[model samples]
Target: MTRALLLVDIQLDYFPGGAFPLAEPEAAAVAARTVLDSFRESGELVVHIFHVATAPDATFFVPETPGIGFHPAVAPLDGETTLEKHQPNSFIDTGLETVLREAGVTELVIVGMMSSMCIDSTTRAAHELGFVCTVVSDACAAPDLTLGETTVPGASVHAAFMAALDGSFATVTPSASLV
Candidate 1:
């Protein structure tokens, strides 16, 4: 099966010191970089989904902001393609579907930020659009924990999001076991 890794919103804005930082997003970012590098070594496809806030009165992810660009360490190579998105779902206002269709991508290995939002949205959308999705458990995150200090970690949020999508939307797996 033709597989493509759908890297969603690994931008600087979501990093720990950025404008809208996620909780421990750096961990997922590192894992995603490793996954992308592996895909490059194995001659696989890596599609980057970059979220650009196009709203006139934007609060977060504004393109002009320093945070809008991708994190320094997770740069895309020449062969990799970038899809700019205005909405949470990468396929929402972008050519993600078209690009995937053109590449004949049957199965998607998904990873990136905001596990409960954009990540979850696109995973389900891919399934509805007939592409099998495998969400990288350790390569996604959510900003808010369950409650307080005893709340769940962002990684757990990642796993829960994956589990919630089971059977109906997609399957979930760890980045190390993906290949």
Candidate 2:
């Protein structure tokens, strides 16, 4: 089956000194770069999904902001496909499914920021769309979240989301396994 690497929301907003920094952003970016380099060397299809927040009150990834740009580590090459999305699911109104189908991509390797949100939504959507998905856990990061009076750790949130995706929506693996 044909395979493609889908890098989602690997933008500056998730890195340190950006609008919404996540836990271990540098480490995740490095891991993502490893897989991205592997794909490039192998001449495999690579698509980048960038979240462009349209909500006026959105704090990060606002249009025309520097944070909306891709992180250097996982930036898309000139000829690579780039999809700008406004929702958690990359396929939602982004024509991602059509692009994957046109490219004959039956399998996807997903890695990116905000594992609990974008990763979760995209993986589930891809599964429902009949594409086999593999999520690289180490190449994804999540920020801490607050639920009512409780604060959840970023690492724990990431792990929980990975666990939820594994064996169901997608196969959760580390970058080493793919690289």
Q: Pick the candidate with the highest TM-score.
A: 2
Stretches > 4 Å off in candidate 2: none
Q: Give per-residue CA lDDT, model 1, range 1-179, as digits (tens).
A: 89999889888888877887777888888788888888888887889888888778887898778887887667887768988888888888688888889988899989888898999999988998999988887778787576655777666776778789866788877788875
lDDT (10s digit) by residue, model 2, range 112-152: 98999999999999999999999999999999999999999
lDDT of 1: 0.83
- The lDDT values for all models are 0.83, 0.95
- Candidate 1's C-alpha runs over 4 A off are 145-156
State residue 80's C-alpha deviation in candidate 1, in Å.
1.3
Question: Positional deviation of 174 in candidate 1, in angstroms?
Answer: 1.1
Error of 2 at 14 (Å): 0.8
Residue 112 error, candidate 2, Å: 0.1
